[model samples]
Target chain A: MIEVVFFLVFFLFIFPFAISYVLASGKERLNIDLNYTRNPRYFSVSFREKLFKAIIKDSLLKGDSRIEVQMSKKELVKYGKFNDLTFNLYPNHIYVITNRAFRIKKGTAVKKEIYALYDLVIEDDCFIRAVACDGVCKIGNDVIIVRWIDAIKSLYIGSGCSLGIACSTEGILKLGKNNIFTRLYGHPIITYGFNEKEYKEFSTIIEKTIRENPVQLEGFEDKPVYVKGDIFSDDDIRLKNVIVEGTVFSFKNIYLENVIVGSPERRVSVIGERITFGRGVKIYGYIQANTKCGKVS
Target chain B: MAMGGIMILVLKGYIISVSLLCILYALRHLIFAYDRFMGKQKIFYGDIIDDQLPTVSVLVPMHNEEKVASNILSLLSKTDYPKNKYEVIPINDHSEDKTKEIIDEFAKRYDFIKPLHRYGGKRGKPAGLNDALKIAQGEIVLIFDADYLPPKGIVRELAVNFKDPLVGAVMGRVIPVNADKNLLTKLLDLERCGGYQVNQQSRYNLNLIPQYGGTVGGFRRDIVLETGGFNENVLAEDTELTYRMYVSGYKVVYANRAECWEEAPENWNVRARQVKRWSRGHNQVMFKYFFKVLKSPHLTFFQKFDGLLLLMVYLIPFLLLLGLFDFLILFFLGDINFIAPVYVMLIPLLFSGFGNFAPFYEIAVGAVIDGLEKRVRLLPFLIFNFVFYSIYISLGFWQAILDSIKGKKEIHWDKTERFRDKGAAD
Candidate 1:
């Protein structure tokens, strides 16, 4: 009786399972052949094995890859490398990503949304709007960044990477060995990082560096900007429908027309010469100028 | 006494012929399987030398096509063919409506728009095409139905295939623009997807004969004129043209990338009329080209076999209906013995099997390849389609065959009615 049951089970069960495995393997091979020119990381599992696996509660045949992980900030702090992973970053999400090493220093809240698909290494004391690193990236301290959509942003070595500008990447970004960043301004990226000895090989990369105080151009999307105090700059100061709380100084041209300076008792003054104002340019101050720039209509 | 012998002889021939057709139907599924799984992927050529592209003339045959004429003309004006090289000829086939007016307006606006108005002709698409053939100045003549919205690059894509000297004609793919209009249109959409995307594309990928649909396909002008142009008597001039081209050692290439969107019939009544007309026309083509397809030397043996099966696709329903008629005769003759041979018992099952599930298999395979497995759930309703086709398609096929034999005088080209969404005409 035992021998008969064994024989029946072997023929009816084990034999079919073995045959199915072979056929499923053949199907897997065919899938590989069809998608060989595409990304090999993606797999197309045929429906037969998938159906059978569903019937037998076999999760192995169904994919264990492509994990959808949701972790708390405390849990993420203890984690490292991820492969074929999509994360649900909810509370306490400090967005720092590296290839195999990702770290967010304590007390630095994340600013921008982080969607990582590349290998990245980010240090603490940073604010990133959004960064999608497709290649090796090393980011250091005291940086505030915004996200931009690109296919491959290869390598970034920003230590005090503050007020950085966008990079001109032709699909690949090659950086030199000693390419450390003190502060970067509204200038585009300069790839091919320099060696330590060849740091003086290049004259200038950044357009302007603001270290003393923050240059705020806030709420550009929804609201017009309002400055509260006196502005001192050696650049062209163009204003439209703006109220100045105090006097301006040394501007190349005071392009102000319908100016609304301080309170009626404490009206401020504009201290520059050249000014060409449109119909609604306003500053709540007085105009103390050497000469106006354009002819008034 | 001799009448009985003759009856027996007739019955024997019937069984053999019906069995042979059933086997052919089975073989069609086999080919569909091979195509769905094993056929090469269809390739599109994006880089073609502009200077080497031939000058082409496009013909749009219209009969009371006022609603669609403006849209079609607008689309044709935007086609990516070289401006000076291609001319649009809208053949206004004696319409009592504003089709001619629309074409005239277009011709007035665009210098390349040339209108061909036919006052009196044979009153069919083939006849309109024949009239337009005279004034078409290009080396190649492409045709589009009045309702098609050919994409910008479709014309260029179809024209590039003609760069191969051996290619005498080319056919492009079609998707339904109003596929979601109704259940009937939705089913028809899936069927069209199966027929074109899966079947025709696979046939092209396998180096088999891909059919030249009357519209969205072009042929060499001189070659078509040499083959005596479109036959006005044949309802399916496309099939007849396919045979003529193949017989003369020329290939009809299937351009899978050259896709155009067309409207499918939205109602069941309209869908029935459309399918019946298709069946009748296809049967006429089958009867006309049955032997010519067999004798074509340009085709491989497999191609010849596949072509013959394709030719007889419309007549399969009739054969199935006849199989039932044979069973009835047998039942009356007291041959309904349960103790008969297993093969004899399985005959009805075979016919019903083909009638019931062959189309489902085709649709399922097509849905799989097209990533439309979600729609495969709707396939159980094919029984209703089977019953309807077995009756109506069989009637249409027989009528077409008898009409050919008896030389029926009046063959009307029944046009499918259009449902226009004025806002979405663009």
Candidate 2:
């Protein structure tokens, strides 16, 4: 019985001590080392290569192609034959468009083709006259177009879109399908410092515009052209040499000239050489425009 | 008839062995309780101060202590001690983070705040302390860790004890700041109260040498330097030094009034690391100094006897293991009668439960009430103080035993986590 008791005590107490002694000695002699290599450019290139392949696979499986208008490549290709087919290519490729505007009228059978050049992807689609492009533009499905677009990189236009006159866009212009632009005006010429009678006539016209559509004018040094309608533009709208009698809501900048803003009671006119509007505008109220301040008889 | 007699003898032997263990543990509880509580002997404030105040260099050794470094610096900045009489030296031991930056910023702000940075990896805590000790300009050097926030009059209180020519070192009471942080901290707080308030005081009352804890302790700078500062090789240099001081016939005094608050580990893993390190270090001290303690002609017979008994206390776990072995043997031998006196073990169990854990519970509850009255967040940690911490201490005993055999003398300073609570500095 005593022997059994001693053995149990030895197992519980002494054995642990013996084991720890051995492990501790072993731990003391162990060493660790690490290596560092400096090659950031190579690392980034390899990382990008992997990322590019993943993006392509993801785009193909789940990409929506509803709004993209197919363009005829028969005139573009050397063989001059039209084909409606999708093509696959390597990851490193760039796509560029030579011309800004190419018209795709109604009942036109357009050819769809893809071009790849050194890490850039370009899609050939039906174009419009006087289009704008800027930056790296990504076109989504169901893009609507109501005006001409000016861009830096790519312009993705939606299908079945009508163009308004004197409309322009800069940078990348992406449009949703079936968008409409009702009225667009070219530069207007108006003389400054008009009499009160001329200001009253201009004020009536501006008030009439504000009563119509929702419009917002911003970044005007003088009182802005109160637009009751929406204006969509691809870039900044410079309002120089322009008079807005109605609500002008533009996606681009609005440049103003020596113009008069008219209200129902009176007309306010200012002589300004240049004023600009950013992004777009939406107005829910009244607007008026005049060339010179004058009394309305 | 002879076999029956032999069976009776075996049964009797088992009962006797079990009863003896029960009696010993019961006695240990009584002594531990009496020493911790009733045995506390303190010198009145008026009786200690008799001479000119000595210049005190408070050496604060820090490593990766950026979080609480500001609080410690601010606390030291508010000390009531004479501005010129004391200097605060914060030794940064090769911290990889913003610890040095914070220390430098504080040093620029306060004239009394001096910062020292070490570039090489830690040689050990003792090595860091020794490095700080080399440049300490005060007559008395006080050691405080990064977590310790000494009370306003602490330096004055600790310094007063130095008037006694025979006193080589003075150890102050270290109270846990976040006593109610969790069960682990509460248990640690209780153990400290039992140890410092009860055991240490009792030893002081009995005129025996109480062990010096590493922090919140002060020593005569010259005496410490003469004794070779602190031995970097030993695990528990404080315990080793305490033994050496006693053998050299120097009196080590316990200053219970000089209080400092320090944070205790809130979890079992940290508590285990701390306790294992402490126990292993104490064991190493015991091994290194046991012979010298016996051979020293300066120590009286009673002091030598007390030292030896303290040495034997480390072996108590082994004795408990033996008792368990006897219980197992009696069960397997098909002798039901032999295990009859197993109830005897319950006596010590009950005593420790009531004497140690119950008092610990009372103190924890009181600390919580105080914290609540003071509107402190530490009140919440009082709930699980016993369940988590008691298990950790048991684990520590096993780890200590293992560490002792391995001759693992490397100094691993397991730094305590600090909270951002501004009220804790108060």
Candidate 3:
């Protein structure tokens, strides 16, 4: 009886496998690689033929008119001119929270802290792209950048610039000699980005930190979460219904009383190391520190 | 009792087959969720830095869009793409209201906003796009539904993806502008987050096939025309384009930066009809592309595998329907014991119900990544989304199959009933 049951289970399992094997064309027999970020497009044909099929035919050969590559910043601006349009990160003006000028770059590096693009105006409906160090950001002919990052009142880039690369988006950027590139047709891209090596270091640091100092949050529920005396949390602090009145810091995320700043009729003030309000919570003063919110006055 | 036992034994084989398929589907989503978590923060804003921006034709297919036409036209006019390089073609697909009048006014106001009125022709977005392509002079054809409001620089952002010699088509993320309107839109906000933020973004990050969603995306006019414009008969011309582009050895780039706002259906019935139409269109594309995807040498093994899974996405509900039949048969025969948890889970019902929660992980991850936990707390309500999808998608699948077998001409493209005219909820 046990043998018959085993046979039934085995047959049932194999039935699906058999069908899948046949239907899948079996060409994808490679072991499943968990590393998703490392994929290179593989063409079935030769490079020459594939290039002709992809670039020449798709682009319609208008790109053949290429001038000699020059490294001067003048050449950069001369090639790609910026249009007069501008994006606003802040409602009325752009703000800079950084103690130093924020520089954007491409490549990977180990860093203590970094951020995705913040405090910059982007009125455009847009998202950021992942650009490798060797890659070029091609702002097509007649295409132009909106005058500036809307939030960053002082942000300026002469060439079409790549924003902080995808891999590293936190802390102070530290670019190495090998991280620089010159053949691109955009703003000379700058800023130290994170790669696999930096990512490994980050994983180790985060793991070690979490292990050494475990978080405790049982007491901060339901009641007003007025963060005081330099509150630091790696995770989000979810609170509701009451007012919050203290300085709080979180390395990851924080969800607090949603401060809805609709129509910049009145300036509301709140001090946040790095904060984002939920929605609808009223505010009375202007935010004093570097802050990011869903809606603000 | 003997006869009942015989019936259970006979049906067990089919049930086992269906169960394994469910497991496969669940496993596929598991990988997607994990990938999304590892890299949900990544976005793709396409960039182009050249002096000569290619001529682009922005195609807006409208049906009774009088209420929203002017707003969208104004937004398009504001885009920073060189005015001379791009033209706006707003095709008025036989609207009963004053949509034509509004579009004509815009056409008169801006030399670029040329309005095309379709009187007596095949009705549907694909049909309209095909007709407009003949008159469109741009090298690239960018499409936006009448409801979409694209931000400044979106045109150039998408056009930049073509800088990569291989990119034949490009797609961008879609954000629901009226996401905070109602419960339906709120949940749809989560759905869209998972669909675009996690699903599409991760697919692009992994260099896998990121689908070219119809709106906020564009294709090389020459390539699309050379290969025959949008398939008028195919409901999901976007899905068809993704498959056809892949099979034809051209790549589709997903631009994270080209984010555009769109209005999602605000009510359950509208949402249900919208999902039904999608499922039906997707299933037809699947049937057409299944073999072609498998045989395409340009696609890597994993790409082919991913494509196959995509083809089966619409069929999940049908499999659940079959499982329901199995349960009914078992219940009528008084062999209820045949559907023990172990057997039932492996069969078709497993993923459709429990495995449906896979998207929850993505939505939660998306919410966490975006720092929107309030919505994450509302994750349980996704069961409503699942229930609606399972029922309607199954009906759509069966209906599409029946239509195909009967040689139905399939002309009317049902538009999702708009709720934009109605004020948003408080």
Superposed model 3: Cα runs more than 4 Å off: A1-297, B1-7, B39-45, B336-358, B422-426
Residue-level lDDT of model 1, residues A205-274, one tens digit each, is 2222211121222222123344555554445565543444544443345454333334434433444444
TM-score of each model, in listed order: 0.58, 0.50, 0.60
Candidate 2 residue A106 Cα shift, in angstroms, is 99
What TM-score would candidate 1 get against the native? 0.58
Backbone clashes counted, model 1: 18
Can you tell me the CAPRI class of model 1?
A: incorrect
The TM-score each candidate achieves on chain A is 0.24, 0.20, 0.22
Candidate 2 local lDDT, B1-426, one digit each (tens): 799669757765755665565455445445655554444333322122122357988888888887778777877777777788889899998888778888898899889887878887556678888888888888888888888777666777777555444567889888777765544554566556655655565566566666677788878888889878887766677887788788887777787656678877776766656655665566667777889999998778877866665654444433444445555566676555533443434433332343333333333333342332222222223223333334443454555566567866565655555654533454
Q: What is the DockQ of candidate 1?
A: 0.01
Alpha carbon RMSD to native, model 1: 23.5
- Compare the candidates by lDDT and give the number of the best one: 1
| Residues forming the 10-long window of minimal summed lDDT in candidate 2 chain A | A26-35
Candidate 2 per-residue lDDT over residues A1-297, each given as its tens digit: 546655664456555544533432311100111111111122223323443453344433546221212222111211111233222221112222222332223332222222212112123333323322333333322222223332234344343344332222222233333333322111111122222323212222133323112223332333344332222232333342223433232222234333333233221121111122221321111211121111111
Give candidate 3's iRMS in Å, 1 decimal: 20.2
Residue A40 lDDT in candidate 1 = 9
Q: Candidate 1 vs candidate 2: which has greater lDDT? A: 1
Tens digit of per-residue lDDT, candidate 3, span B199-268: 7777776667889989999998888899988889888899999999999988787876577788888888
